[model samples]
Target: MRRESETCTYWSELIAYLYGELSADERSEFERHLLACAICREELSGFERTRAFVRTWKARAEEAAVGLPAISLGSAPNQPQWRQALAALREFFALSPAWLRVTSAVATLVVCALAALAVAHAELRVSSEGVAFRTGIFKRPPAQTKAASSEPLYTQEEMERIVAERIAAARAQMLDRIQSEQLATREQAQSMPHPSPAQASAQQPDFEHRVRRSEQAAVALARDDDAPRLSDLLSEISD
Candidate 1:
């Protein structure tokens, strides 16, 4: 009983394992569990025996159906094909587990119900008006149409104004988004490590070199008669 309780969780897997339906990892795991589980071992043994018995029974039934001498009354025919099929079907269900039998019964009932509905010319419709079901030999006319909503529709100018307002709102949203992104980027930049003095100096253009270039440009400009001298400009600015 303890073993049965322990095996309750694994019972479904046991069937799959027996039928080689489990994947590689699952098969390995179950096999390892089986080695330690006496309940599972015993269950597997019983299942094997039952399967063998069923196979033997099935073979015998088939042989009997084919090879057995049909004792018949004068002019009476052998068993019908349907009887054989029914027998086979019965055997199949008999061999199946309870769940399969219940499922088959449920499926059969559903099929029969659907077939009955089809034969009855059933029709179902759902609309704003309401749900409707019809069943008859002849087709029924469509239901009355629902009344349109009382709300007024927008005119062309109203639609254009609405579109313009939407565009403005969208543009404002884009601008706000851009501003937020710029702030975030600036904050991120500030959060990062500051450059070392040497690194900073290396990155900056040479101030003395820039001054020399400016002086050279000023001299060139001074040589041009049309341009004012740097000295004169400085004196003028000082004055």
Candidate 2:
């Protein structure tokens, strides 16, 4: 039992010894100990058996690995080569400098924006008036400056008829404007407070009497002026 306990205590050393990983002196000492102890001898034999089993397992695993092709976890077997290339490119870019990546992204965005603007700026319009250009970057085209022809497109009689029609339309518009103004004036007058009938009558009489008094005064002043009268002429002729 004591020998058994001692052998158990050297369990880690026994594993190292089975792998031949110990120093020469330590291996020799352990071998001498094994010779003197039956329990140690049995334990070393068990370790040797376990090492043989592990070697057999490792050999079998290597053979199996050799028979099968290597499969990468990063890429699928059936995926296209372009996808793999793109993935490699992405990885390269990811490993590139931060400034370079940012500059490329910004340059791409700016180019796209400028291209959109340019496309929008290339518009042209045609109409009966003339050709016109519409753009976001350039100024608007000037209005058509060509003067109308002096000669009328229509005959004289037709021109007169058109002129008459325009005059009639203008007259109608003027009449409509006058009527609207009169109606607005009438509405304003109706909105105002008016004097009572008796107050209006009283005011009229007073105003008429004042007018008559002013007329009589004007006649007296005219008679007193230095103009010859008909009675004076007759008296002068008799004298």
Candidate 3:
């Protein structure tokens, strides 16, 4: 189990190295390891054999395709020329493992994308400024001069005038609010029923009498702290 796990670790590395997928430093490092590791060396040899077998299979497939006699389209109505070519291509790769096939497909796609980009004159740049990607007959419009702002600029005097106007408007709004509150209060008061002159005169004596009695009780309580209680005031008032 331990040996198997250790070999498995180098499995991907071996494949990458075989496919020329590793960078210079990684490839150098892997080559040094490969020389010392018996398991990796053995696995690498096995892979090389498999790769050679696949290549031979592909060559034979191509030869078989070439050796085939050209037949009229009507003679083989079910198998089209394009279908035959596709079948030949499939047969060519069929000997290779699934991983190898997938890797080849992906590598081919990447190569095609890069080729398209090169043909299109695609440019990609990264710097402190920012990442920029541009393609095809693109001239970066001469770094536009900071466009003069379209907004109207105010002079110091104009700015002061605007601030003064804003302050005046705020004051006006506050005055309007105060006026509305006062008007609402006045309207509310006017809506309420008012006592007549006779009613006012009648309540006035009782109100004044109550005030005089409260003042006298307060004075007595101040003069005698012992009589501070309301019950004492009530007794005095009763008397």
Candidate 4:
């Protein structure tokens, strides 16, 4: 009986008592209370386990869909591939994960549509002017949803943070590439120490010629910078 009480209090009410987020007292209470309540203890254990399973379900779903490049939304007659896929997903030979995404996407679409229908349904019950103030789905410039223009914007700090994160990632990648190239260069220099003794004597004379060529190329680049269109550089170079 003591063991069962300990599990119950910990299991069933512990999560919900989190009250969306747990209060200090609620948290303290749950921690202490679970020790005595077996049912709640089991419920909490089950809930945590269930949450982990749900997380795995999503990860698995993403993996299955990863290789599926976005299907052509081209003038292909079937534009509602999502809807069709949603309907037919269960039959696909793909693993259970893809099916889960299809199910989730379908449910999300349905919920959005139903919510829209409900709003429109309510609005229609009371006959108002032709222009409903609802969010417009049309991009036709004349058909404006002016309310959207008034929507609250993200703060400047949020935008800066996002940009900073991107810049940091790029900098990190640049550093890695620089380090890798530097390592490769050191290794190459070490491996050939002085090239082969026979080739070293033959190639030593060509070093000055290559240096002169590189200097000429630099002068040519400086000259072209003033005259060349970007498109000229992109012209296909046939080997």
Off by over 4 Å in 2: 1-3, 6-12, 68-239
What would the per-residue lDDT of candidate 1 be over residues 43-121, giving only the tens digit for each residue? Answer: 6776665565455445546667799753433422245645544554665565456778899999999999899889988
Model 1, residue 187: what's the lDDT?
76
Distance (Å) between predicted and true CA of 77, model 4? Answer: 42
Measured on C-alpha atoms, candidate 3 has an lDDT of 0.65
Using all chains and alpha carbons, the TM-scores for the candidates as numbered come to 0.31, 0.25, 0.28, 0.24
lDDT of 4 by residue, 83-171 (tens): 44443343231222345568988999999987986755433333555555454354246765456565436544555566567655765
lDDT per residue, candidate 3, 1-239, as tens digits?
12452435666677789899999999999998888787778767755655544544454466667896443333233554455556546644653456668999999999999999999899999999999999986655677688889775875456656656765576567556655655665576567578899986776786566556555654553454443544444446656
Q: Which residue segments of model 3 deviate by more than 4 Å?
A: 1-8, 68-239
lDDT of each: 0.66, 0.61, 0.65, 0.54
Query: By lDDT, who's the top model here?
Result: 1
Query: Per-prediction count of colliding residue pairs?
Result: 0, 0, 0, 26
Worst 10 residues of 4 by lDDT: 230-239
- What number of backbone clashes does candidate 2 have, counting pairs of residues 3 or more apart or in separate chains? 0
Q: Using lDDT, rank the candidates from best to worst.
A: 1, 3, 2, 4
Q: Quick one: ranking by TM-score, best first?
A: 1, 3, 2, 4
Across 172-218, the per-residue lDDT of candidate 2 in tens digits comes to: 67556655655665576568567799876766675566556555655
